[model samples]
Target: MYTDNCYSKIDNISVEYWRVGIYCRLSKEDEGTGQSESINNQREFLKKYVNDAKWTLFKIYIDDGYSGLNFERPGFQDMINDIESGLVNLIIVKDLSRLGRDYIQTGYYLEKYFPEKRVRFIAVNDCIDTFRESAANDFSPIRSVFNDMYAKDISKKVRTAFNIKRAKGQFIGSHAPFGYLKDPDNKNKIIVDEEAARIVKRIFEMYLGGMGLTTIAYTLNEEGVPNPSRYKKTVLNSSYVGRNKTMYWDATTIKWILTNPTYMGSMAQGKSEKLSYKSKKFINIPRENWQIVEGTHEPIVSKQEFETVQKMIERKNNQDFKCRKTPRLFSGFVYCGDCGSYMTYNAKRNHLYLICSTYKRFSKEFCSRHSIQEKTLISIVIEDMVQMIQKYVDVNGIKDKTVGLSFKDGKKKEIQDDIKRCRDRLEELKAMVKSLYTDKVKGIISEEDFLELNKGFTDEKNGINEKLQKLEKKLAELDRKEDEKREIEDIAKKLLEFKTLDRFILEKLIEKIEIYENAEIKIHYKFLNPDK
Candidate 1:
């Protein structure tokens, strides 16, 4: 009876042929482990075992240098595809850990997947074979729990190492920002390339010259200055560069360059961080949490110029009033005398009138209407403008007086010298920091001492930075005054040919008009200076 039963079992095993696939995984984190766990070793062992057992060697799937914490692996998916296509009836791996470290996924495959498909699964190192077992006999669940613990330990170690690097102010990102290149000698350092750096400087200068972000962007495109992403791709040979080829200007790109502190040689990091190891989401941290290392690289823009642009943007953004209506020949030129507010246009009964905008918006109790006939105001402005224009033409001296020179040659030289000196000092400090880092790496200086000295140098560097900022501001002020003089001179020369005032001339010349409570008016003209 025993011999007959054994023969029946052998017949049952021969009913299906086993086509086996080898799975191999090697994580970068596990590089230091024994060679037995290496991908090559796993492949070799699986091949030899399959050949000796007379099983059909179907294929090998490998996920090299990948973490086993998740089952979102490419090779693993390919093996699953083979199973669904009836090409592979059995799966083989060197160990259970190679399959995956996620316990839930491992258990799902072992308990449910293999049985439903009549697929055999085997882990050689763990001595677990699914083909000879009932559902209750499988020990994969216990093995998966251990694999998960291994993954958790690896994650903790990685986090600790990252914290240490961050504290040292080393650049740990895979890619640097636009206009900077990672130093070849030191991966943690960044150096500016002159060609790209010049482009960055031009962008900043255009922004400070009163150009709107969109307008500046359009000008850049027209001038054929390569956009940031395209420039990076050309220089770095990166395949991941932005491929948008429409060549249209975008305001967001201009705004990003204007706001980035990196252009000032400061490093700002930790803007966003991962929520957890399991979650792929990131959350932004507060600015206070940012790790900033100043004077870490070469600067393309001065701190003062950056600050000036920021202040200009803030002023415009927070303005309380909106002046949408275009000024007529004398609409904005007139103001109310009593309330000291702008004289706004009011049309009634086929006649135009000027009234105090502030008084009308608030209430009669606040101020008087300060009304005046628009025709009278227009007639008066036309007479004054014509007289001014004629005077400019007659004497040939209005250009010089109206376009007054404000910058002294000696002051400009002094400001330039001050800026040069500060920059020289900054470069010297950077060289010293680099030397100190070399010493620390060679064990000539202890880590603690290096940090202390670095902090001291940083403080001194910041002080010099403040001085440099003051000098740059003085330079910008001088430049603005010079531009104003030139603009007024040009406008005076143009106005000499005009016979009478028109809407186009009025729009170009006047900014606004304020009216007071007594019907007196004041005109504020557009500053001729581009810097203004």
Candidate 2:
């Protein structure tokens, strides 16, 4: 009878060995609470508990810096996986909140899931053990609801802090936009990156030269120029340099560049906002609703260029032509002399005629139907462009005129010398500012006096700098004009190659062909009198 009692006790002891999975989670908010709230601390506590009870330790699952609001914690998922595979017969956590703060999800997993799988769930701090729960355990549901409310409160506080920073124009992002970067000293301040800024200027130049957006994108791709997104990736990762991926060009991307007011030295914000506190959805506000602050930053595109392009786009959209099936050489270029509307093309008796587009809107007598034959118009335009090109090629004539103008304008040399002196002084001031720290450290000046003196110097320097910059810009404009004259001369030298007019040549050279009443036409070519 004593041997039978020993065998029964052995069976009872074997049944008490529980295969336990320990889970731990630490949120960002709870990081500085104490070491006791840490993942390691939770693991140590559960290990002691399991060891003291002589339970079998299956695994220790941990998720660090994760939110308690969701049960999607990595550690919790791993524990669930062990349970599903029959590796764990029981789950243990430091507290009920460690499992999840979400009331519905927490209740479902505890009551339904654990029961169905025959797994014992226990929260050591909560003193809740499923194996020994009584009718008083009804209060567990209320505790879960309180935990969910705490999560909601934490989420609201985080969102409010983010909005305050955004309103202050602080860059709450990892990366800045193209052509600019966050200032190292102050993350809120945006600073120009000269190398990237040069590329941006080139893009604008190419666009102004009549290249389509797609063509410009293709050219940049061919030259191995990185797109904005790809450039950002490389800048952020030095080890991943030269690993560029091709970006597909689309109308929306091009439109983004055209519409961005940042290029105009303005800050545009609040273009999009969240729909609600609970929803992650965002809705884009209209442009009129966007908060724009002018002169907030340095501009990439000039105000004049931006405005001019806007007008050109509007004009192009308003113009209509009847020769849609066949491309008219001057479809967008021609304007009716009477109505100032775009002229439409008509083919009758194998003769193409350009007529007033406004004839349909009003009586013929209201506006004389300005009409010109296509053949005659083309002949006139071609002859006029060739003569103009020939005139541009007369280098001796140009030299004589330039010499005559120089003699007439004696004050030009003196003005240029004064501008040069101002520019040199501005450069010296900039160099001085950059090296000011060394002077201070060497005891050349006291810190207080140095700062005061530097402020006055900076004020005076800025005044001179602005004037110097204006003068330099004027000089650049003159230089560009000279370059254009030279380009015209080069084009003129190749005029002999075009013995007859063709669509390709005409489109490349001409800007417009204006047909007036009495069948009179005027040609406006690209290089004709570029100096004017």
Candidate 3:
């Protein structure tokens, strides 16, 4: 009976059919620290074992400077593809830890994936072989747990060290801010770059001279000055991409530089932190939570000048500068009918009128200047409102007007369905982009094909996002109009008692007032008009 069972087991041990794929990984922490764990050393050792066993060496895969915590490495993914294609029947690594550091995934691959795929796996240093039954194979799970613990410990220690460095007011960032550079003598300190510092000073001077942010950006771009992003790549030789196709100066970039305290000799650190050690996502830290150390670097602008500029920026943003104390009644409601630009509020010489902002700011060639007096607009709006109130009073006869203010269900449902489809497509596109990047990294797809597909995906994504924004804005406007309509209808019920108009009631009744040529006026009410 024993001889018969031995013959049956011998028939299944097919060693000659083994096609081996040797895998090796060397992270930054492991490189040059251990000679035995080096890529070349791991390759030679695994090859010797395969030769001794008389197995065919099909290919060797290496993931140099890649962490074992994630299985997204290009070389590792290539080996998995070969196994699925039936090209590789066996895989060998230096040790169990070489496969991965994450215990859950490493265990899943070794215990389930390899077995289900009918492929053999081995770790020479750990004496693990799936084809042969051994005590070492049973202990692999415990080993994986230890490896995971080691990675966590290392991550904690590195974070603690960085925190200590930041507390000392040291400049630990890879690149200095726009107007500064890392000191040659001490990398932890920063000094002003004279060439860039001159540009920084010019920006401050322009702002103080009553030049708007957009005008300053346009002047710098017209002068052929490289933006901060282009300067870093071409001049500073950093790997960070500006992500700007044209690399032109813009108001957003100017505002960032203007607001940064670094120019005033303060070193701000820990502005953002990663979600976790395993994930690459980062969340920005609030300004109050940021670690700020004053006088940690050379000053590019005086403290007094910086404080004055900050105060001016605050005052301009408050909306009080345009009207001197409070916003006008029709300040935000008027627009130009021809060019569709917001109308500027003019109160010059006791004359109140709204004119096309585009014509006032830019050349007349871009747009036409059409003006309508505020008094005339109010008169027109109040007269139309009174007519509507008379119609409602004739029909309803002073009854409650706030009971039924909701719009028809058909319109709301159509908009809601469109929003749902757009949101679903956005999620699908995000997943597709991630998969496309992985395929490109694994060499399954060519670079040219990837770029073409990526561009198409990006265009579709941008269009979907813009559509969603518009749809959401439209829905919000509809809801706000319904509520305002109810409020105005209540006031309209009392329109016969008080035949007067105020800013509050006018604003609640009208969404926009458009000024056209030949002194023509068009009013867009928040609520629907039965007369129209």
Overall local distance difference test of candidate 1: 0.73
Pairs with backbone N, CA or C atoms under 3 Å apart (clashes), candidate 3? none
Off by over 4 Å in 1: 1-16, 32-36, 134-137, 241-249, 303-532
lDDT of each: 0.73, 0.68, 0.80
After superposition on all C-alphas, the RMSD of every candidate to the true structure, in Å, is 28.9, 28.1, 17.5
- Backbone atom clashes (below 3 Å) for every candidate: 18, 0, 0
Alpha-carbon error at 507 in model 3, in Å? 13
Over 1-532, each residue of candidate 3 has an lDDT whose tens digit, in order, gives 0112323464476677888999999886677467998999999999999999888999999999887788999999999999999999889999988999889999999888998887778999899877666788888999999988877777787678778878888988877888888899999899998988999999999998998776687678768788888787787887665434346777777878887888888888899887876777889999899888898878888888788888988887674465566547777888888888999876657778777876665435456668777777777877877876675555544333323354565887799899999999999999999999999999999999999999999999999999999999988977886665557667776655686777777666667878886677787766555544
The C-alpha stretches of model 3 lying farther than 4 A from their native spots are 1-16, 31-33, 180-195, 210-215, 221-224, 233-239, 242-251, 293-299, 302-532
The candidate that achieves the highest lDDT relative to the unseen native structure? 3
lDDT for predicted candidate 2 compared with the true structure = 0.68
Model 3 worst lDDT run, 10 consecutive residues: 1-10
Q: By the lDDT metric, which is better: model 2 or model 3? A: 3
lDDT of each residue in 61-106, candidate 2, tens digit only? 8989887766667778888888899999889999888888888888
